[model samples]
Target chain A: MTTTLSLEQEVARLIVEALHLETAPEDIDPEAPLFGDGLGLDSIDALEIALAVSKRYGFQLRSDDERNHRIFASLRALAAHIETHRTA
Target chain B: MPAEPAFPLTARAPGEVLFRRGAEPVTTARFLAEAAGLAARLPAEGPVLNVCADRYLALLGFAAALMRGQVTLLSADRTPQRLAEIAARHGARCALSDTPASLPLPVIAPAAEAGPEAPNPAIPAARIAAIGFTSGSTGEPQPHAKPWGALVAGARAAAARFAVAPGTSIVGTIPAQHMYGFETTLMLPLHGGGAGHAGPVFYPSDIEAALAAVPAPRLLVTTPLQMRALLGTGIALPPLIGVISATAPLDAALAAEAEAAWGAPVREIYGATEAGSIASRHTTREEGWEPYPGVAFTIGEEGASVTVPGLPAPVPLADRLEWCGQGRFRLAGRLTDMVKLAGKRASIAGLTRILTAIEGVEDGVFLAPPDLDRNPRARLAAAVVAPGMDAKAVLAALRERVEPAFLPRPVVMLDALPRDAVGKISRAAIAALAWKR
Candidate 1:
């Protein structure tokens, strides 16, 4: 549980840093959406996050991967996907 | 009377594949049959609001509208307010959508199956096939009507300029509803005799997969923003015959990089919704834009107005152009307050209006700082003076009013905006306030 929480926090920080969000990483709700209504991120931000995740986790997040809707749904989901797919 | 030129200016074999939807090849016969079937069910009168998410469905809706002699309104903005405004303005009777959602107008999902035989209807050249809307400076959408003949002519000109041969698969990263995407991806395949990849290809990996799904001699129709993202990923792409970019200016270095990396020439189209592709340039080799065949640019004391072959009158150009020799010209600068980001355009003044309209927003200003690197991901920033409201609240209000692309990020909260004696916030001042944080 601690490891999962830490990974989610790490992803939150990565997203904040990559997207240059005004809010602090800790302020981001783990369950809230990373796009549209929540953090107001758009498709470009999604690409930016994908690139950042690939660089950090050594895995590619393809938009048409079918799991992308779940992976990018929130910080927790993204962190979990990274946990499973990260080669590094 | 002179005989009216029919649509689909180029002849295509009935068995030739015109579009690739997922793994399925949609032949010319299948496309025409589907369009005819959809056309039979369309409203008898008034224009149609086509908001189909799928590229293939959007094209079918467009062709169906064209067959019925009804103008199709193409807009990427699907907000209820925007749709309502369009419906009110054009008296749109129904909307053609693939997604299951409610809209201001009656929604019609185009699921028309292909019939046994294709219908080769003779569509008049003078028919207003589509009306593309651009976000006006006054916060209203300005409609630019495109005739079928003009679209066909523009597509053929582009095909010739880019050397796009028949059966070449065209993959696009931009939406089919945008003017550039519509012309390059959708219209190009129809009139240019190329096949279009008919799924949403946004992310870099998706673009690669879509390209891999298509056949050889592929042409990529995309904007500089998407191109930048695609290149940034460093993802391996299938061999491309050529790449055509528009909506935003393509930097020479990036163009050269793409040409070198992909081993294909990078071409850019200079056009607007008002005039569907007017000129083309081999970005890596040429600095000046050469007008397409039969298109003439007259530079008068007022400004430059382009005379497209099929348009009724000359349309004034919004960009200041410096004429070289022959039919080539260089873009000087934009003459409007419009800022384009990721192929979506919005006026700064209009954005400011939306910003201030929000309750508890005392004063605000939006600025798109000139990105020296021309980064496709560059976004609009804002500084607002809202006493009791937080940035999230302000943004939430803004989200309802503007498109996601135009939403100003980092809504800076200020005690007061720096205004001069005349109560005007200069561009320099806005830039400083917006970017300083």
Candidate 2:
């Protein structure tokens, strides 16, 4: 559980750094939505995050993949996906 | 009077494929049949607000409206407020949408089921085929009328410029409602003797899938933003004949990289909603734009204005141009304070108006990043003098008023706006404040 929490924190930092979000990484709710109503991020922000994630985790996030809706649902979901798929 | 020329200037054999709907090829015969069927069901009287997310359905709606002598209103801004305003302004009787929408008028989804082939009918050259709306400086959506003949001429010119030959498959990332998308993806194929892919290609994967779905020789109609994301994905794309980019200025470095990766020439189109596509350039090879055939430019003290063959009068351009002689010119700078991001256009002044209109917002200004055109991640920034209001509240308010693409990020709170002796705050001041935050 601690390891998962750290991964989520690392991802939160990455998101803030990549997207230049004004929100602090520690303030981001891990289970809250990252798009639309939650973080107010849009498609452009998604592309930026994907590029950052690819560089950090060494895997591509294809935009049209059906799993994207689940993978990008929240900070926790994205962090979990990275934990399973990260090679770097 | 002499009969008007047919709507599609260039005609292909009935059996030839006109569009690829997903993986299935839709022949010209079938498309005409579906359009005719849709047209038969449309109300016989007023203009139509076409909000179809599917390119093929939008084309069908457009064709049906043209056949019925009803002008089709095209707007990329499909927000309920904007759609309602457009419908009310144009007295639109109905809206044709593929997906469910809470629109003001009656919504009709044109049946995609194939019907019996129908004969092609001639539409009047003078008939207003479409009215494209762009955000005016005053915040109202300005309407630009496009006649069927003009649209046909514009498409033919673009086809010749890009060498979009018969059997070429065109796929686009931009939505079909915008003027550039309509001209390149929809109109170009109808008149260019090429087949189009009915795509809502937003993401990199979608672009790759759509391109792979259609047969080569493929032509990618996209903006610089999508091109950057697609290239970043490092995904192998199908062999493309060529690439055509527009809406925002394409960076020469990015264009060169795209050319190197795809082994295809990257061409940039210079046009506007007011005049459609007027010029093209091989981005890696040329610094100046070559105007399309029958497109003449006049560079005067005021700015540049282009005279196209089919439009009734010369349309003034908002871009300052340096004439290179023989109908060629270089884009010097933009005359208006318009900012384009992710293929969406919004004037800074208009955005500022919305920012200040919020109660408790004493003063504010919206700042477009200096590198917005070249930087894919560049976003609009704002500095608000809203006491007791947080950035989240300001952003939430803005999200309601503007499209997601135009929402200001990092809304900086300021005690007071920095104004000069004349009581005018320069853009540099706001940009600096937002940058500091």
Candidate 3:
């Protein structure tokens, strides 16, 4: 699989692991919302997700990041985040 | 490691004040000599409770406990019931308290003994050196046993991580009897070439005044809850070499502000009663929690299982972690804190950690409404102590930094956050208070 697709799958797995999504990884749409009604992620989940990504990718997840809400907006956005920054 | 004799301790420096506060301070060499004197005089058998009100004497008892092969039992609220529980658990026949006359067990003033001082040889470790009670928010109080070698190792590790400059006097706001307080304030100061303040520090003003009592290059050891209070009060303190915060999460922003206010590096030590402090973070926003040079980490489900460079195997963690490389990792809160909301996973501990870090907040706690499922919009209710700022103000500050979903709804204003002995606030307690509103 391409890095983009792989990253997308990894994000799905992480969302499932972090928030314990009931659905399969493939069931998650990249463009669907993660924080709002789409996947229902909250702040605590955001921290867990952010820290997990930082540890796996090697850099802090800055709270001041302007595109934070958008980056964490969906599986696809998160996957793209991982794609641009995966040290591991 | 029993007294192997190969690595015998030196004839430690005399008058090297082990701890000093008020008008007097203790020298390590003097303290060690006194402990040796106490060792020479203490009965060969039966446990002696130590409650020397004078921090110096209590510190002497601590060193004496190590040297004499006696077990020191500690509890901050050493009420009659707790004392009785402690004495019975250790089969103690005598108790050392500030007031010797009132103790249930036989008590003695532990007269200051004098002798030509000499550094004690490495004795057989433990044989059970110290005992303390758990936070006990769970079940019947559990006892945590501290071995001598482990105590020595923990003290040395903390000193090395903190790098107390010479002549540094360590002062404390927490009781010296509690494990966290005992290990850092009482023990670390001695081993790392410093002294402990004699008087007890109660309020933030008390801490400020006590800081003045101790000599320069001072280390003020406290908790996140207390640090928040200092930031709120905006007190000008003495020249603090470093600040050691433990027993609770020190929010990054609050920590940074404290560092700014005191003009000293605020070092947060990650530790617990079960395991002594093992790691240090110089900055709140610092990404990695560095293990004391000799401490090691191996990440797993229960968090990071740690093995000090020479420790046998590795011990597991009760908290979560973001295991980074290069002998450092980010620490999340306790595992028990991970919560489930309508089958959605989140961490109440993490939420609370973030809450207290918000500017102007003294102490903050986040609780999931018991009827969370019933009230979808209920979100999370919080009880906060923000003295100068109101709930909306705190919410606005949090909104400026964090996401909208995490904004604490219906923030309950409290004079102070409720915490048990170990300074932990339970979600159940939070919910119970929210119900009142």
Best by lDDT: 2
Instruction: Judge the docking of candidate 1 as incorrect, acceptable, medium or high.
Output: acceptable
Candidate 1 lDDT by residue in tens digits, B250-334? 9999999898889998999988888989999999889899999889998866778999978999998877788887669998776
What's every prediction's RMSD, in angstroms?
A: 2.5, 2.9, 19.9
The DockQ values of the predictions, listed in order, are 0.47, 0.35, 0.02
CA deviation > 4 Å runs, candidate 3? A1-88, B1-11, B100-103, B111-121, B135-138, B309-313, B337-437
Candidate 2 colliding pairs, count? 0
Candidate 3 local lDDT, B1-437, one digit each (tens): 65442212322365566667474765656666777776666566656677665666776666666666677877654445556767777788666655534656777566556667757556554355677665332223466677666666777777777787657888876667767788777767655556778765644556777888877888888876566655554567888888988765566777888988988888877765566677888765576888876777777775677775323346666667887776688866555644433212245666777778877888887776654433322356778999998765776566543334445656778887777778776656666777764
TM-score of 2: 0.91
* RMSD versus native structure for model 1: 2.5
Q: Which stretches of candidate 1 lie above 4 Å from their native place?
A: A65-71, B1-5, B8-10, B300-302, B421-423
Count of backbone clashes, every candidate in sequence: 0, 0, 17
Task: Encode model 2's per-residue lDDT on B1-437: one tens digit a residue.
Answer: 96666565236678988888988998888888898899999998869999887888988999888778899999987668889999999999999988767887899987776778787777777778999988876678899999888998998898888888888999987778899999988898788768888876776777888898888899999888778877887878999999999988889999999999999999999888889999999999998999999998988988889998678999998788997765579988777788876666679899999999998899998888877756756889998999989888898788777777778877788898888779888778878877765
Error of 1 at B433 (Å): 3.5
My TM-score estimates for the predictions, one after another, are 0.92, 0.91, 0.62
